[model samples]
Target: MTNEFSNSENLFPAYNQHEVVEKLETGFKKLNDKFINLLEENQRIKQHNKNLQEENQDILRINLELNEKNQEISRNNLESNKKYQEISRNNSNLIRINNDLKVKLQARDKQIEKLQNDLNLEKQKNKEIQRLEVISQNLEKNLKILEVDEIDINTINVFKENNEQTNCNINKNPTTALNYSKGLDDIRIVVGLDFGVTYSGFAYCHVIDENMHTNDNWPWGVTGQFRTNTVLRYDDEFNNVLYWGARALKNRKQNSEPVKLFNLYLGDLPDNLKPKLPIDYKKAITDYLREIGMFIKEKICHLDGFDYFEDVLLVLTIPAEYSEMDKVIMRQCVYNADLIKDRDSEKLQFTTESKATALNCTFMFVDCGKYTTNLTTRKLVRNDPLHIDKVTVQIRDFYGSRLINEEFIKFLRERLGTCTIDLLKENNYEGLQYMVKKFYRRITRSFTGDDKKFNYELDILYEAPILLRHVSEEIKEIMGEIIEIKYNDIKKMFDPIVDRIIRLIHIQLLNNKENCSTIFLTGDFCVSKYLQNRIKEEFSHQVNNISVPALPEVAVVRGAVIYGLSTILYGTEFDGLKLVISSRLLKFTYGIQYNWKSSDDLTHNGKNCKFKTLVKRDTEITPDQTFSFNFKPGSKQISESFAIYYTQKYNIWYCDEPGVKRLGILNIDLSDVQLDSRSINFGLTFGQYEIIASARNERNRQEHMATFCYPDDDF
Candidate 1:
């Protein structure tokens, strides 16, 4: 108030100042009240804002949860789609499997139809055979009646005796007649398989004209290949067959290796060479045979209008030296190839290599003996009539190609290191083998009559440039290096093989007791002039005559075809033909395992009670003969086992003689017989190529089995 209204109003100014002060205080209080109200309002707004923030946070949380649920739902839909796709694929697979099963069912139906047709044909053939038998009986009777008028009383008596003996023999072997009835009359073709170690050949013949046929041609290198290489190739790891035969040779020429000598290691491998083999040899043989089967079907057995399988008879030739076990393995190889799946069928036949070769030689003797001065002028031949009978034949293993091939292989390895040879084999095995073979053939063919210069060129050995000539020492290097070989060096290789052959021939002659004036040489080795000359030179003093037929290498295969026809025509209307081998000489002494019935039996009194000889070696035998024996057990036993033993040696001196080998086991169950009261009857027959044994109990029930124990066999 102007400093209190300037005192004026000194006293009055004091009251005015006090009133102004009160108004000032009142104005300050109002502003303070407004400030307090604003504070309260701000507090209330802050509270509201805090509540709104909490609510907003809750809403945000709920929204996040909803988003997460949506994502989970999408993931579940994806999983459902994947399940549906998997189910669809499985359905497709099931449909394919159903279609495959349907195809198999149709094939089975066709097979059943074929079997039924064959059964009907077999029935018809049986009836025809019965009718022919009756007609044959009538003709025989009429011939006897007509002979009585044409001959004297003594001849008539002889005819009666001969007829009675023939009747008795026919009654003894009923199965001989059964075989005639069982044979197929619709046979149009016969096949022969000569599955040899070094070579293989196949032949076929028509029964109508009886002319043999052969597959003289083959593929992949040369023409007129009657025999292809027995070779096979596998994968790098040796798991599966890649190729076989000539095709194998082609592949081997192009950086692939092959397996050879599989034939010699069919069932048992030689100890010296076994460790070198890395794969199963039997499987290799099976694969090789499978290819051969295909070859035969495609090349030789493809007749124009007939099913080759239905009208064909297959005959396989086996080495005479092969044991029963080896024969079984050969049969298995044939079966595994699906060539002759049923061994029990009459369509399949097995003949010995020696037997067939002998028959063929005899056929030549009958055909060509009249034309050769060597046969007609010899004293031994003059004493012996030109009849095919009464002459003994000797078979030996010296007449084989194995020794020569082995020596050639040895020569290759010595000139070339095994590592280098192995590498070359991996690179071009066939080229190397073909080169060696050409040299071998050249040497064998050209080196005759003591010639010193046997020339061979090594330029064809490989694709790389190289020169091979006479060298002083052996050296092995790459393909481009010079390879030196000499005539004397080559002669050294052939010398040992020649010596072995001569030694074997000498042994064979020493073992033979029969007067064999005529000697027959056959097999692929017959193609070797050196072998032939050596044989003729060495045996000139002992043998009076020698003969080598034309196409001597094909003799075994051709003879097999002849044998098939002979069996079919035997004892039939065609039996009168001269093309028949009526008898065979046993090469081994056969016997039965015998325990002496009485201790006092003088024949075996001081000897080991083991064997009784039934047929001696060198004795002539008919294929339809049976030998009977009595079995009397001392004790009461219901079952027993017996064995058959054979000896190539002189005799079975003891039960356990080193030379005596157990041939087979025969089992007999005598439960139905009076074991303690009666003796059992047993019989053995060699009517076919294999042995057949039969046992009869007291109840008259008979059991028969073809028993042959195949032992480990080696060449």
Candidate 2:
């Protein structure tokens, strides 16, 4: 069967084999289709996965944008919070200020009430005085009715003397009779400021107390010292004041420079002689005055019933040689510093340093200041109010005590080489100042002319090692060693200044018309023992009474207070009881350039700029005296300007003269005056420190006043 089957199988096997091959091929084709399907599914799944990745990236970007927006919002909120906090702080400050103002107002109310009560009391006193006058009048009438024989002789004489005294008192006190009608009664306190070149001081006096009080408690000053250094230190740019007064001299800031001797700029100084200032001289002075004014206000405003504007009178002492323009500048500076209310404020008054010093006593005052020395001789005209008259012309010289300090500096420059001194000055200026202070304190103040008695040694090399490398070996050796300042070395410095002062005093005495009974040594330099001894030695024979008042350094300041008080009190009810400086000699001849008209002739002179004299130089003039000139303006003229000129010369014919300088122009407004009566009376009242020019229209009584200020070119 297997064979046959095999044969059949062979035939069948051939068909079967063909069938098996067909089946195999079909199976392989099925597997290939399955593989193709799987490949297509995998491709679709990969496309879906890529789409999911893109969606995730979009979500992540949206989240990042949201976070960035949130951060920006947070920053805006923080900035708003800061601005709100600043506003809140400002509100708090405003509330505090409001509270302070309320308290000040309440205090002012109390002061007003107190002043009202005083006014009432003064009125009652006036009524009582009137009653006493009536009773005295009745007694006089009864006495006149009685016969001489009936009345006792001694009683009659006593009654007559009493009547005469009452009459004299009534005649002298006209303002008192008027019951305080004048504004002089408003003065409560007077403060005097002596702003010296090297030192400054202030003195205050109450009108009621009439007792002088000086401020010795200056910042960084000795306990008993009345004056402080007039030095100021400014920042590098000079826009701000870093330090002032004694503190300025002690500051060691490397970038700051000290400004002193600025007071000299207020005088008629040559351009070369003026000090080099980083800032404007006026600004420097104004800053200094502002500080001092604040100190004064603080000191005086604390007193009961004291009003700075209404009750206080500030008397500022100036150099005698200061021109009217200089005085005006000082006044303007004072106004700018808030010391006075305005430019024309009467609260601020000026007096010469010499005049102020002379008010202390009738003597030859030798005020030896730092930069200038002034010699003035005054005669005691009346002792009741302590009236003094200037006898000799005031003399001012540059040979002051600072020259001694300069000589001492020169001595140091010689002892230590110039290079070493310059190096020290450049590198360590404070150290140099310290050395000078030490020299002044240890040697200069106590040194007498006698070398045998004085033995002092100054250590100039103690701070020199730091600068040794920059200097030469010779300078190094000199700086490394201490130098001995013997009495001769000091005497050499003192003799030049002291001898010049002595010569000035001698010349002053010779020129003085009145006998210089007493020679007063005043000012900061007057504190020097050597200066005092030398002055005494030189002038003891000429002046029998040579004296230095207690606290002589503050003499000018203290006398300034007296002067302010006396000026206000003089010619009033308090005339005989208070010190009064009644008269002063004019320093320059004041005149106006105008066309002189003759009363006899109707023709006008061709001379248009003729110099008409008003007040001559060296003429003794009282403060109340006025020289008046009548002027008739043209009918069409609306204003008339008078050109006032001044000169040291006795006589000048023309305004264009060499020595004649234009003081100022006084303009009189004639618009209000009647056309028929255009005559104006122009008057000039020369005071101790200023000239007041006034123009009055006779028809309308319209007056205009101005103070004489020299032209800018004169300065």
Candidate 3:
């Protein structure tokens, strides 16, 4: 208290002082405790402040990362928007292209419809022309008959003046009629006419000389050429002939188109296979034959001691696949051409091209023509006169060198547009022909499948400049003034045809029972070095020899002359000097429909309309073989008719089978036979060229000979 009241007393003051010191110590201790507590609390507050600062730093970093992610998402959205816009533009372009295509397709459809209409109109016009042609033919035939009668009178008069013995002989044998001329029985000259689809030629042989002569002197006067183009041209009305052969091919007029490949119509082909013709095919054939016949006649007349009416024998080479009706039509055409006086004249004989080619050699005959490839296998029977027998059925295919040209045309249509080609054909036919001719002459004949050595360029614009106007921009960009024909391009065209020919040869060899050691190639296409090499390479192991005869292009025509000589001089002094076809393998089974209820028949199963086979398929039949059959005449029947049918089947009971075909009808006169006669004997003789039917009465011994009647029989 006042420290004790200033000294209230010294003794009391000393005690107060000690008490004050203790109080001061107690206060100081309390203050020190408070200071330590305050210090500890200040340390905790500093730690808390440091933790808060770290949390604020983490929050700031997380916000910055989130902002970067938002910016990346914005960039992706902008890219997606750009892609969608680009797709929309592409869709617009596609729609425009589709519309343009639709327009072009409509235009093409319209063009096709117009072409169809034109074709129908052309068909109608063709029908009218055919009718007119028939009428014209009949009139021409009547004129020919009158001319023949006049010629017959003149011939008789000449015979009476030249040789009285000939007249006496003719009078003694009334059956000889006006044909009893001095040289009528002797064939001094034989002419072989090879009427091919692409080429035509004639070869003449003198019987005494035994040497063949081919007519190489054509209108163009080209040497070493025995064949001419089978091309013809008519006037604007198609009623008169304008040009023929090479001349027709050279002449390019706007009035009329050239007619080619008419020889294909001579076969009995399906309607789909037949081509459209500007004129009647028969007339076309007749006209062509007439032109050739005139040349032949003029040439023959120039020969010494040659008479066309008596000494000339024309042997026409026909396709092996021709039917009897086709043969008949050909014969009629030949007669109409004035090659022979009568349609049934023996002066004109028909033989297959394959058979004629086979007769020319002992090995297999392969004729690779422009339109067809014919194969025939023959075995050597006698080598002295070169007699050969048919070993296998003939094979004919439409694969030929012409197909190569077709493929080339397709190539052109592809390279340049089809419309461009069509326009060229329509505007400049000659130019189109020139282009094809150039390709055929330069490229097709020279390509050897060697790619490195092959470098050829065809001048397209020079030949057909008009095509430039019609070609598309794309075509122009690809092909300019010239078109390059590579080795692969040509090889692709040749391989298909070559493969087919090889396959045909292989099948023929496999079917042949005899070992085919040698192969003989003939015809124009055989001249191809590529074809020869391929055949050699393909059959090197199997075949021993492959020989291409000299002048193989004329082999068929020359062989035809030899065949004519052989057949006409058979069993004579000149027979040994010529090649003979001894036997032929029948392609079909020939039979006559007859009742099987015969009295002497033991194996009759009571079958009606049975097929009595006379010659079976694949059976080798000789020229002189005759099949005999006997049938009793009905009591009241004065005449009988037999139906002849042919089939490729072996076991056949009826005539109406799927493969059976009615060949012809045979008529027999039984009026001379008595009703009481047991049976009337009938005989059928099959010749290489014709068939003869004979009927004889068993009691009266009266014989009547007849021939099978064809469809369009004029004789």
Candidate 4:
């Protein structure tokens, strides 16, 4: 306004200045209020962020806990599902068995009805006939009961004689046949059994006394004799056990027949031989072992110092040649005998005959016994001095003395003509067994490959009356008086056995790269002088020394005694182990089923072949080494788990080839686990004699019972 028009402008300018100052003060006050509000808001926001962060941490911890809980629930679910499937399978088997029995019962009922109709038609004619009919009806009812409790021999189709299959049926609620839980803590004595084909015995020792111990009075006549013949006899109908061991061979009855070479047939026999055996082979084994167990309980377990049944560790020695399935059957027999609880694997330990010999011998050993032969070597591993493991190397095991005995039996049968055959055909087998036992015990043990001959004179005094009535003049002339067997005839039997043993020795020498100088010979069959001489002569160049232990017959059982004692001493931590077998060679290829990486690799025999190998055949494994596999649930459903399937209808699906065996399914439950796409992990550790398996989820480890079911093995 140009200084407010001269003099007037001075007063206007002053007023304007005062007004501007007031406006500036107002603007400053408003700005200060806004700053104060922003500072308060900033402080409040910092406090809020701190509270949120704490809440987020709590939520994360809760999620972790929930995941852990979910994992545990999933494990439980898995276990429950496995149990359900097992129960279902068992129920199906029972149903099938029941149906078979019903069919048989219907057939019997029809037969009875026909008999009754005939009896009714002739009712007034004869009371004796009615009485006979009642007896027949009673017999029919008893036979029905027998069918329910007993296994039918004709139905058993034994797969492989070499690798016998065991019948494994899981019960809904399995209860221990014997009381094992009560006296377990009081165990002071351990026992070892050598269940052999030709002979059987046991050794025992106190937890304190480590030296070998044997029952001097082992069933038969003498005080020092520790072994008895492995034989069992059944009554007329083959439904009941009449006697066992030496008594069965010695005592001949009208209706009883001796079951010799039962151990060789522990697995099912060939199809052709199945019908010849009128009773279940597995049952026969169990029955025989039960009697043996009873003998042990009375003689050793019930001794003054040890009165309780469970206060003992019973170890068993099995043939090294036996397959895994065969071992399982033997274990089942032990369970059926009530010697130990069925599932108490820790209490019951099994050692191969060769392994036991290796444990006891200072050098390599050859165990030539009744049914099989085994070659073994022991080596020391000093890498871990504190827990030094004994590594046992088993070379070969195959059919041994029994094969030779069969050849001898065949020769005898040929020489004896129809004399023994006619008796067997007529169901009069007692005399034949008696004659064989007499000749075997007396002459067989004394045979040597020499010009000297043995005289086996048989007295047919009792059979003279029967022979006279049913004999042609030519046969009568040959069998008139005593039948004598000469030494040359016995030599024929020794030669084949000796030759076979020599071949085995040659193979043993070839396999042993170390040129082991010494060889130890032990077992009942090794007691034969002729066989021993032949082995020595054949291996003279390769082997520097071939020696048999003084107690060849009892060496295995005695070694078993040492094994048990060593387990007690060395198995503990505070007491250092003086002897131990740390590792062993793998006999077969071990692996698990798995999904294929691509569909192109899935086809086998026009079906899907899905599997991956974990352990290859002949691969060396250590106790510390672990094998693992993964199982991913494809579906979102919690109930779904890893399932095993077959590629072919009947062909076995194995990880490796040549001869593939069937595989069993693994039932792992994941029903309760929140699997937002997570995989289940499994691991395996090679134990002393078993492969230990474990399973785990994302959050925690899972517990499961591993059950392997094979179609060919079902009973």
Which candidate has the highest lDDT of all?
2
Alpha carbon lDDT at 533, candidate 1:
80
lDDT of 1 by residue, 512-607 (tens): 334447666665555567766887899878988867767777787887777777766553322121222367766777777776565555354466
Residue-level lDDT tens digits of model 3 in 555-608: 778878988887666522221222235887767777788865556553435546
Clashing pairs in 1: 7-10, 325-710
Which candidate model has the greater TM-score, 3 or 4? 3
* lDDT (CA) per prediction: 0.59, 0.73, 0.72, 0.60
Better of 2 and 3 by lDDT: 2
Worst 10 residues of 1 by lDDT: 369-378
| Residue 19 displacement in candidate 3 (angstroms) | 99
What is the TM-score ranking, best to worst? 2, 3, 4, 1
Give model 2's TM-score versus the native structure. Answer: 0.55
Which candidate, 1 or 4, has the higher lDDT? 4
Model 4 global lDDT (CA atoms, 0 to 1): 0.60
30: Cα error in model 3, Å: 99
Q: Scored by Cα lDDT, where does model 2 land?
A: 0.73
TM per candidate? 0.51, 0.55, 0.54, 0.51
